[model samples]
Structures are given as C-alpha cells and as structure tokens.
Target: MPHKVIFVLIDGLAWQVAHDCMGHLQGLCEAGRASLYRLNSALPSLSRPLYECLLTGVPPVDSGVVHNQITRLSTQTSLFHLARAARLTTAAASYHWISELYNRSPYLAVRDRFTDDPALPIQHGIFYHADSYPDDHLLLDGEYLRQRHDPDLLLIHSMNVDDAGHHAGYDSPQYRNAARRMDIFLSDHLPGWLDAGYQVIVTSDHGMNDDRSHGGILPEERQVPLFTLGSAFSHAPEVAVRQVELCGLAADLLGLSHDKPRNQELIRR
Candidate 1:
C-alpha cells in the first residue's frame, strides 16, 4: 500500500542531543517500532540551505541557497512539487522560509501565513516567521492541517530547539530541555498520526554547536538524527543516509517518481 507521510523536521537538533534527550523516540527505537539513523546535513549546514537540500535533493552549492538570507522561491523541484505532480496532497506547518521556498516569495505574513490554496505546491500551510515560534503551537497547527486536509505528505517544521540552542549553547540545560519538551509533544501526537495511517519521519536540517551557531564543518553542526517510524521502513538498516536523499525517500514513501537517489536499503516496500 502507498503510505501517507508526516515528516517532522526538528530544527538544529544534533545526533547526540537527540539520541540523549528525545527519550520517547529513543524508546520507540528500543522497542523496535522505529529505526534511528545518523544523517549528515548538506554542506554549509545552515537552515535555509539545508532545508532546500532536504526537499529538493540538491546540495546548497548547486541549489544556490548557500545562505539563509537568499529569501526567494526555489528554482529546483521540491518534494511538494513532486508530490503534487503525482496527484498527492501536500501540507506544511513550518517556518516562513519554507513558505518562501515552495509557496510564495517575499512572504507577506498577513496574506500568506495561513494559506489553503489547492493550486499551490503546498495545498495547505500554517507558516510562522519568527524563529522563536513555539513548537507546541506549530505541532498543533500541523495536527489541525492533517485532520482537515488529510494531506498525503505533511511537513511539520518546529523551531524551538534551534531557538534554544541559539540562546544557549547546545550543551546547555535550555537546549536539552527544549528537545525534551518536543519529545513530550511528539509522545502526545505521534500515536494519533500513526493510527491515522501516516508513516512518520522525524529529523533535523542541521546540528548545533557550542558557540550557539552553525554553518561550519564541526560534527556537532553537521551530524543530525533521522528516526523513521512506520511499516514502510526496514526495522534495521545499515545504509548511510544523507540529508539530500530525504526528498527521494519522502517521494518513495508517497509512491512518487523521483530523480534523486534514495537509500533503498532503508525501505522494506
């Protein structure tokens, strides 16, 4: 059966921190309901660039989203576009940068923040501009979108963990607490998503550093975590997963044709 997917992008969450602090996800892995993999973020490891990479399967250098301030519509085809082309519905509760990339450019918060136009690549959206937007609110927005639209591909991007890492170091209590809080939120919502027949992939665009910033080559800045929870994935796969490959993986999960390379080892169907 073709699977509907809910992809949760937890911004700035590193492998170590996610491995340590996301106890609910970790418990799922321990119980064999999910699989965890180390994912290396695309080069330049910044939010906008990696976000493009995650959706387009194009590296930052190639996609021309080398920095966060580029603020324009994506030139490359994204997961949203591919899904829509395949006649699958798409929705997102994400940062405004996502709105800028896939839906519209120069996002007008007043008009674009809560979009539901079927003509758009993201057929439904609840976008936020602030980096400090609460993850709880974003998740709720995602759930609302899911229940209403029943999108085949739902993207939920939360920013609190990244915000906390920017305010405190990645090793600080605030950062860990942010991850823990998101874990609790996931604990609350994930079961419902799963029961609704949505295969879930929780991951991050990039990692965090002790300097409270990223865009560097440090492992802490490039090493993120990917947790796949659904029947479509292998219970144990040793394949190396890259951030760029996420687009293809998502496309594959949604039963769409994709040009990008997907880690087929990670899939059972």
Candidate 2:
C-alpha cells in the first residue's frame, strides 16, 4: 500500500495549459509512468460542485453542493470523513470553498484569504492568505504539514494560476507565467513527498477555455487532466485510450470502493 496520497488540485487548469508547460510534469509522466485521464465536470461546470464530485464520488444533486455556497446535505459523506473512518490522517489546503467543505478536526486545512466577495462562502481549516502573485510561501506551509503532521492524505490547491487565467485570459502571458510558476512548485517542492514514498495525484476540477470563461457546457470547460505518479501506478496510460471515471479514479487511488449508483459503463471507452 502507498504510504501517502497527495492530491494536487490546480484550479482552472486546462489541458492546453499543461501541454504548454509540460517540462516539469513531463518528467514525472515519464519517470513514474503516469497517465492522463480526461474527465468531465458536472453541469454548470463550477468549482464547488465538481470538487464535491471528485471527493465524494457523487454528483452535485447527491452531494448537495451545487454551487459555491454550502448547502444542507441529505448524505454528508466526504472523502476526508471516509479516510478518517479508515484511520487515515487527512489534510487539505485549498482556495476557500473547498476548505470549508472538508474542514474537520485533525484535517489540516488552509483557506485562501484574498477574496473580496462576501457572498462567497467561508472555509474552515488552516487558512493562509496570499499577498502577491506567486505565493511561494505555500511551499513552506506544505512542507511543515507533511513533515510535522505527516498526514496520510495531503491535498494542495493552487489558485494563483487559475485566477490569472480567469482574469487575463488563458492564452495570455500571465497564464503561461502562472503555469511556469506552478511547474516550479511541483518540480522543486513536491518531490520531497515522493522521496518519502507518497502517491501523488495531480488533477483539476475542470478545464477552462482560451477566453477563461467556463460553465458553458463545452468540452474544454468540462474536460480536465488527471495525472497520477508514484509507485502505486506503474504506467501513465495512453491518451486517446479508455476514459476513466473521475470519481472512480479517486476511489481507486485511495483503495476505496465506488459509492455512487451511476452507469459506470458511461465512462469506459
């Protein structure tokens, strides 16, 4: 069994962005025999709902997190809760909304504190405010959490690149620069976990378009990249190959069973 599982959630990251900034990730894809799985987000194509889907293996309607705000859940099952039930130490550091959804005890969470929108929901956990473009300071926080806490599961959410791409357009230099910076983080900061024997899963909630506007029900907005690295998986399965279910991917990586009642055949190519 893999000692650690690290989920790296890059917000608003599209396949094109990864293709453009492929150097850092490319090596991992090659070295660890990584694979890319193209998966679609839920309808309306927002962050919160899709993230819920990724974590719980349930859709927005089932998870009761259709939008960015917190809603009453009929079944309040989360990946963190499940991990804890299995006696696994879990931690997450995300932008704002996600941290709120999974902010429970023993779960190290860091909420982003750069938002001005009051209507936006509040997230609990280990919150960290980003002061500038490249919040490289997160590296230190991530290291601290991994070394000191040594959580069995650690999730890192980077929004600087996503915010830049949304505002300045995905094709702009700002987005490219943000991607490069993210690459640096992965190349420089993440390998420590690998050295310590962690299974790293890098993915996105959904992809963005050149205009940077999502929620349009388009493939670019719905389809995102899913890459897995470490000793758990041997090969980076081929692209244009069979499509893997997003929720199933998460469940498989964590050694959990699929909890939803959907047509699992739909995702199989």
Candidate 3:
C-alpha cells in the first residue's frame, strides 16, 4: 500500500510549549523520526495565511489567501488539487471556514462538491466551532470521517488550545491543560491509525504569545511543533532538530505533484 497521511493540526501550539506541556504525547514523540521539531510557519504567522501556505507550499502572494477576509483558496497548485491528480481521497475536520474554503457553506455534502474546479476533490469535510466542540468531540469527528471515507489524506484541526490560550492567557493552567488533554485523547486514538498503516503528521499552524494572541512575527507566534511518525520519516528516531519550512513539508506529505523537487521524493520513501 502507498503512504497515507493522518494530519493532526493543533492551533496556537508553540513548539516549546507543546514539548514542555504535552507529556501525554511522549509515545508519539518516541515513535517519530526525531525529537521535538522546531519549525517556522509561513510569514505573518496568522492562521489563514499559514493554512494557505500549508496547502500550496507557496507564500502569501501566490496562495491568494493573504487575509482573514479571503475564505477560498484560488491557488491551483494546492495539496487538494494535487491529491486529486494523484487520485487520492482527502477529508478534513475543523472550523466552518475550511468548508467555506471549498465554497461549501452549511455543509451540503462535503464530498467532491467543488463545481468551479474539477481538480480539487475533497472526499469529506466537517465543520466545528471552537467555542462549542471539545477536543474529544473533534477527535471523534475525525475518527468518524476516517472510518467513513477511508481517505488517503485526513486533516484534523483543533482550536481548543488556541481558544483556551485566548480566553485564559497563554501561560495559564487552562492553556497547558488544554494541550495536555488533547495529547491524551490523541495518544489513545492515534496509535490505532498508525497500526492501520497511515503515516502521522502532527503540527500546529502557529504559536501564541503572552497576550494570548497571534498574527505577529514574534518567535513565539511564528514557531510551531512538527512531528513525523511512521515510515514517512526516514531519519533516525532522534535526529538533530532544525528549522523547516512547514508548508513545503505538508505538500510533500500529500504527494503533491508539481511541488516535488527533483532530488527528493516523499510519498515513495
């Protein structure tokens, strides 16, 4: 079988904070090709921009999702598009904006409904609000999607940590507890996915500062934790950590065709 991906995206999770606070994820850390990975989000470190960069492996200008006002991605080279080209099924769970990005508001069936563009075909997409859904519920939704579609690419985005960070401040117990609990929940479930032979990619879009807010270029805001587990990571279990461009990594994980460099082939390895 080919390399499938299960992506867990924790919002506003700083690399230092995730490493310091999320001990429950230690098993996954051990399962990975490296220890705590220190990586940079796209410039501006904002959620929307970083999401676009993640999908397209391009900067703000090319992705066409420069601000919060922009909901849909116009970039043709996005992971979704390339996944379609590779004939891989893709699914996602998270905020409603994600569904809106595919021009599907109100959730009228998130399976390959992009009428405007035939290239980007989403197998399934679920929308959840940050204030309402708990971390466990989000994980359940992701699991449900995984079982339902058996998608080749799965994206699980959680806002619990970011929401907690904003409401109680980044340094508060609430924020740390949020990350810890998320780790525990995923710790229980993620192994099953790995057992099923899917490569796991755990990361955050960006970090939060002391003010409990992001969208800045501060180190705390721009840096995020990146964890690669299963066979996709070829390095040793504890290689030297280094700075990485996250968007390119994401594109590579999904086997995006146009974005591949001549020297490196990710999905095959």
Tens digits of per-residue lDDT for model 3 on 174-264?
A: 8888888988888878668978888787888788888978887888888788776776666443333322344455556656546432223
Better of 1 and 3 by TM-score: 1
**2 or 3, which is superior by TM-score?**
3
Against the reference, the lDDT scores of all candidates come to 0.92, 0.62, 0.69
Error of 1 at 186 (Å): 0.4
* Shift in Å, residue 144, candidate 3: 0.8
Q: What is the Cα-based TM-score of model 1? A: 0.98
Q: Candidate 3 — which residues are off by over 4 angstroms? A: 30-34, 103-120, 236-256, 260-269
lDDT tens per residue, model 2, 175-267: 778877888878886667777888777887766767777766777777777676776664534534222244454445566554633232222
Which lDDT value does model 3 have at 132?
49
Candidate number of the best lDDT: 1
